[model samples]
Target chain A: MPGETFKEYVDSFSYGSRTDLFFKWLKGAAEADAEDYIQSLLQELGEVSDTGDLSKFFEMTYEAQLAANSPPGEDPRWKYEDAPFTPLSKPLSEMRVGLITSSGHYVEGEPHAPPELSDYTQEEGTKHIGEYGRAKPFLSAVPIDLPQEKLGVHQPGYDIRAAQKDRNTVMPIDRMKEMADQGVIGEFASMAYSFIGLTSQMRLTREDAPQWAERVKDEGWEAAVLVPV
Target chain B: MSVGHISRAFETAGTPTVIIQSNVYRGRVVVMKPARVVYTKHLMGRPMSAPFDTERQTHVLREALKMLETATEPETSVILPDAYRIAPK
Candidate 1:
């Protein structure tokens, strides 16, 4: 009974903001079909009743599982060969984190980015004040990540690096690796993480998400530092 | 994991994972376990909550390995196990 009651107030992510997501997942929870899988998610959130903060709920759930020695119910692998994967188990402080953002184009569910869309810096998506000033600090994107004072000049030049003549020449993946080699991390994760910058369409987000995830998998990284700008 | 099929692929691969909406505290990363998948409404290319009414799109993620503990899980979990992709236009 108590367990059921606790379930009543367990909030996950957006709290009441995205209750639709939970319901969507619930519609197909049983089948695990794209539909069933979605419904199961809805059922999970619907349980978060009027009792508490969803974010705290997140912390509490992890704390409880850790205390009880419970499993998060994931599939396990018996045959890992190359290198033993080290879980992301740092004190949360000393992690080699990364960031990404847009606030410009490439919206899904609506219309994708135009053939020639500029980055947030060039676009008039926000006023002279810049949305980054408010939420920018929270994200971990490339150029925009510079300190608050560097606002206009904070462009990450990711496009230039990525568009260079050679694949290895583009981007700062090597810089990340160099940091890793220098004992800059308890354990340097293999995968680098990212997010959609400015697009507002859920559909566009859905399309962009898997690629970032794949990067994490490809790099064999132990953990992800998702910022969602 | 497969490009679109993140949930199934990760769980089957046995990779331990965690998913959070915001970075939360600076450097205070939250690690969850036994997760076949760890979805987040969080977007890609960027790593923080986006603009207003963006749908957050109700994102979901999958995981392969558990959090290396034999502990009991919580009555309230942050993520619902199921997540969906947008229908084709």
Candidate 2:
């Protein structure tokens, strides 16, 4: 920590404190250099330039930058050629159900997804995946069926304190079980799938999603509930 | 938006799907058109509501599940009646 610059110390301060300091510094710093300073500062704060709106980048937290850059007034970055057309074949109480999520829930002691497959950049995983697109083969599924004590949250952005205390907040393995027990759904798929949901690697998704669909079908699940974190 | 894409993928392949999501992804979900989007006002990670709040969580899930039978249109969205109260940090 020795000889760190004043700005480095400022970066170490909490976001609110840093924002206050940033305004103070902005008032004294050269107006012409403001944009450059912001861009560099954001880069220093672990934001990858390829993601989000560079124009208003300084205003976003590391967590929200990805959405900020979603092509002006259009939908999210990627769009499919086909419209959604699938319809349920049965009632909720008669269909088999399963859960899938992008929250990065994993068994407590198991190996995390290799960075090549599911990037884990601590913040802005979508950004990392975008930059790392198809650099390696992407594996589609991370199974979840452990006890609450054996579950962990690997997704970043947003507070996971509640989830850390109880995995059901996101994964809801126990809740799914309850739904099956109560006849809300006829049955829970014996296994559920979890993935690092923040990725932008469409290539990987295009490759893996149909496979996941097949897996769900193979498991006898008539429906899948997608929980987005 | 990967969630939206995955939903589309599953539905495209003939498996019905429902998305339990926050309003944060509403625009994209609307555009991409998942089978059903059960929108909730919960915090990003707590889509089923706060941890260990079993009754509320179960209620949210039931509502989302029910959409499978009721959502007849593409990109159908059913908003949850309750919200995830953000506890003071």
What local lDDT does model 2 show for residue A182? Answer: 88
lDDT score of residue B15 within candidate 1: 36
Give per-residue CA lDDT, model 1, range B30-75, as digits (tens): 2322232233322222221222212222122112112222112321
Clashing pairs in 2: none
Let me know the DockQ for model 2: 0.44
Which digits, one per residue and each the tens of the lDDT, describe model 1 over residues A1-229? 3454222323221122223221222221222233333344455466666543354444333233222222234323211222212344453225544322232211122222232322333323222223332232111233322222222212221121111221111122333344445554334453332322333223332443444445555655444322221
Candidate 2, superposed: residue stretches over 4 Å from native: A1-72, A80-82, A115-145, B86-89
User: TM-score of B chain for each model?
Assistant: 0.25, 0.86
- Global lDDT of model 2: 0.64
DockQ of 1: 0.08
How would you encode candidate 2's per-residue C-alpha lDDT over A187-227 as one tens digit per residue? Answer: 88888877766444565466777777787888898889988
Span of 10 residues, lowest total lDDT, candidate 1 chain A: A161-170
**Highest DockQ against the true fold, candidate:** 2
